[model samples]
Target: MTIHLSKSRLKYLSRLGLFLFLLILSGLFYASCNTQSSRNQSGKAHLGESPMTDSMVVDQLIQRSRSFYEETGMRAEPFDRFLQEAMEIASRHNLLWQQVRILNTIGRRYRDRSAYGEALRYHNRALTIAQNINNKGLLSEVYNQIGVVFRRTDDNAIALDMHFKALRLAEETRDSFNISVAINSIGNVNANLGRYHSAIEYFLRALEYADRLDNTLGKAINNHNIGECRLKMGYPEEALEYFQKSLAYNNQIGSRAGQSICYNSIGAVYIAKDDPVTALEYLERALNINDRLGDLMQVSISHSKIGEVYLLLGDFAKADDHLNKSYELAKNIGSRFQAEESLRLLSRLHEANHNYATSLEYFKTATAYRDSILNEKNINHLTTMEAMLETEAQRNRIYQLNQMTSEQLITLGRQRLMLTIIIIIFVILAVITTLLIYQHRLRIKYNNLKNQHKLLRSQMNPHFIFNALSAIQVYVLEHDVEKSTKFLTDFAKLMRLVLKTSHHDFIPLKDESEILKYYLELQKLRFVSPFNYQITIDEGLDQENTFVPPMLTQPFVENAVEHGVRLMENQGHLDIRFKKLNTQMVVEVEDNGIGISSSIDQKQKSGINKKHESMAIKITKERLDVIRNDIGGKVSLEIIDKKNINPFDRGTLIRIILPIVSQNN
Candidate 1:
């Protein structure tokens, strides 16, 4: 196998062999480089497809990311990578809407992971881009995502504001998906605020919209929210049903995170149902899923649930371990609510274990956290309430100013019209003397009618104001600040409504009903004697779209409350009814109190409330007259003393007929 040679000849052969080997090595390297270049060229060719094919690729990537999101309920590794690739392609192609969409997806992922700062940063960037592109749909979605971030961070006020803003944008664009999302977000905020009824209402509405769109994710979330609301409302059985429904939907979509949430919710319901064994089963399932998904916030919540189940089973050691783990995880994620719950459970566990000192320490910490949370919630509520009150006050002031300005403009317009008419009459006086005379008569009649109308409205203003002030003074004299504050708020609202509609000839029947209800409530508050009232509208009548003269029946109602029911020995009852009868609107105001005749006699003899009685009658007559002339239709008011029909029935009844006016008219 070996060949020997002389030294010189062997050296020459070794040199020659080394040279050949170096040549072969260089050739092999060159071939390998050529093969790699060809492969690179092939890959480049595959990537640089037709424009249509590139667009398809981007769309496919985006769709894949969305599918992954639906499957995982948050961003899985594949989902993130897919979105990244799509983002790169979208950015390079200047596909702005797609870019914004991808950014929103990423923001939601960060939000789901409890990375609020990163979530907000991404959402804000997407918002900027969406606004620059004037993409309302994208803008709405980004706003929604940002709202979720704020909600997760417990900035409920800001979160609610953002959700409302998103709702407005979504509604404007008619983006059904975004609309449902925004509504669901708002429901979550309300739930956090402990407005479970309002939250349920919002969730139901969102669910309806989602059902119409067949959106599985939306359905799953809404169902979960409804379950939480029901659970809070003390309906464990109902809550369990909703939670199971949510789980079904989540399963249908293969949403692991959603399934985890449902498992936790179901566990809560089972605990409420006093089935600790079943609860433990669900809690463990939720914890396993949360741990695998790396959802620290959810993990904390799940552990706390498991701890609660263990505590219910009297397993102190297990409870302590789980609760401590929950507390640590909650602290890591900055979830004060979860941390507080865990601490509270820990305190209970320690107390059960007879560790009095440790129990007290944990109890103190839990109490501190609870108080802090309550303080934040109260501050938020009070701030929102004050702002709303201020806004209403400002609106009233602005409306009053506008009303004054409008009246001045109307007076100026009337003067200009009168001057023009005078000029025209003078110019054609000789040529059309008879016509001018007839026109002059018409003008005089119109002016007299207008004066009567203004006089009737003015009469209502002072009488109502004086009575309201007198009632308010009673509360003030009693030094009842709470009652006085409440009375003042109601008075302000009524005054604002009256002032707003004072100048209008007609307003919606719905608005009139609201005013009547408010006035009745205010009157009831003033009187020591209690009264009951019911307002019924015919189902056939369109209260919102039907129009009638403003405050047409208000004077009669006032008379019933003030004269008939004010000093009644027994509790008085009032019934008001609105009906659509053929071409006319019929209203009935009946009161079970002193007869009108008796009331009139009492007031006349005492000389008290005489002026109010006269003004009421005067305004009623004048209003009827104006309405009859203006509409050129049948209008009548009839007052009946119930004693006249039957002496035992001591009450007053009034019926009125008005020409129907549609909203458009």
Candidate 2:
């Protein structure tokens, strides 16, 4: 077992217990390597007959797995079973954070084996658990692991998204290890995408963090990634320096996986230098270590590189053998990338050997895989563009921060003071502006009230009063004293009601409805051809508690009665409805007589020379506009001609929407 513990994880264990546990793990690994005992037997022997609590068992299992990680390195299969057992125990005990850790570990193992689908499944499970626990540290670790899986699968866009999310969460939680890991992972994606310069920037930033934490593993990883970017940027000598630095760190930490990667990277640098002899030594070293560790992904890559070197040296037989093994291992691990490279090398080797037909077949298959990969790369380009823009912005922000000075601090303070002064000035201007607007609105309201009083005084036109008085006198001369007295009394009541309520801004719906009834009755009395009128209020309305602007609907109702219902040759009908619609009140005055358009044309032909516009209507609309402006409420007047709906139908329908104002109890 190869076990590696993070600095943060190691903080949980006492030095004495960790040392003792390492001693036991070393002996067990030694015995397993020598075939003295089965791996399962060794693990059980260490944990058997212990009366530890569930938490202790989980801790021991986790520590044991960590030891396996160190000893066997990235070849984590030997410890995977123990970790699964730990996961089961932790789940049974509802140890949520333990489950997240175990899931992330297993996911990484799957990632190492190039089982991307299974890796994502485990990581997603970890992500869900971490989110449920609301633990930023666990969430960051899981996001970083998921990002690595996507990067390996050549999904750079998703990889960048995941890595950035991990970086943000790690920064929020001050998880230094994860922050470095996430930044380094982003660099790897950029390097693979051919953005070597951008990749180098990220690598250097990540290195700064790793150095601060003195995290040997983080340092090795960042150094190796920087080497990759440099090598891709065509700086083989510079790349060698970084690779050596990484190798030394890995050696110090005894990281077999990290050492393997450094060896492979160095080999690649030598290959770029056209030094096959030197490259072969490093390539073989990586192959041996990866083969021993059972990391098929790295093993495949190593074989492909070694085979390429052999082909370069004109060693066809050795090249064919290595390339075939590389392809087989890559295919078994589902690594299409490695398989494609191996197939391409094999095609070249066959071509060199004059095997034209076989070479062509290999070339065709490799092309198919390459085409599919290119299609995936096209999708990645969209994310690549976005990542480039974001990375540039991040660089600018970092540069600005790094360039800050004492003088800049003084300038910043001055700017802040200026901003405060500007805000105070703006506030004063806003208050003055508000007062001026209020004064202007008050003047407008005063003029509207004046017009309203004038319209109300005009409501009792001499023509209407004279007509009512003449009707009363006719009833008196006909000796109908009771009818005369009743008509006179009703007319007086209507006049008084309108005068009393006209001065108020708002009156109760009950009082307003009473005024409308009284006016309609007096008008009905004056009509020679009598009309029936109905006024209804919605049952749901609390008429006494709800108030509306006084007489808002009176003009429209008067128009309907006078122009629409009064001119009918047959029996006329007037219907007024006050209904509630949601938060607004709806008032509808519908009359069946001559429609509004017809009445206008009739009056024009009859030489009624006055303009058709009613003063009462004009004043009422101004009042509604004021109401609408002041309260920002819905107040509208819509007149619908029934003749437009059907030519034979004659009537006008008036709808007034008023804001509902109710007194709070």
The prediction achieving the highest TM-score against the true structure is 2
Q: Estimate each model's TM-score.
A: 0.44, 0.46
For every candidate, C-alpha RMSD to the true structure in Å: 45.9, 30.3
lDDT of 1 by residue, 211-299 (tens): 99999988888998999999999999999999999999999999989999999889888888899999999989999998888777889
Give each model's whole-structure lDDT: 0.80, 0.80
How does candidate 1 score on lDDT?
0.80
On a 0 to 100 scale, what is the lDDT of residue 544 in model 1? 81
For model 2, give the 10-residue run with minimal summed lDDT. Answer: 1-10
Candidate 2: C-alpha RMSD after superposition: 30.3
- Residues 1-665 of candidate 2 have per-residue lDDT tens digits of 11112221233333534555556556646754675457555544333323358778888898899887767755458337789899888776677777787888777776775566667767777776676457898888988998888887788898999999999999999989889889988988998899999999999999999899998888888888888788878899999999999999999999999889899989999999999989999999999999898877889999898999999998888999999999999788667777889989899999999998999999999998888777655544444445445545755665677578656977986997587568656655565565556556666656666566556743665666788888888898999988788898888887887787766667788988887887788788778888999989999899998887777777787777777777788889999999999988999989997998888888889998658677777777776776665555688988889999989887999888987877761
Mark the 10 consecutive residues where model 1 has the least summed lDDT: 1-10
Q: Please list the residue runs of candidate 1 whose C-alpha ends up more than 4 Å from where it truly belongs after superposition.
A: 1-88, 288-300, 325-340, 360-665
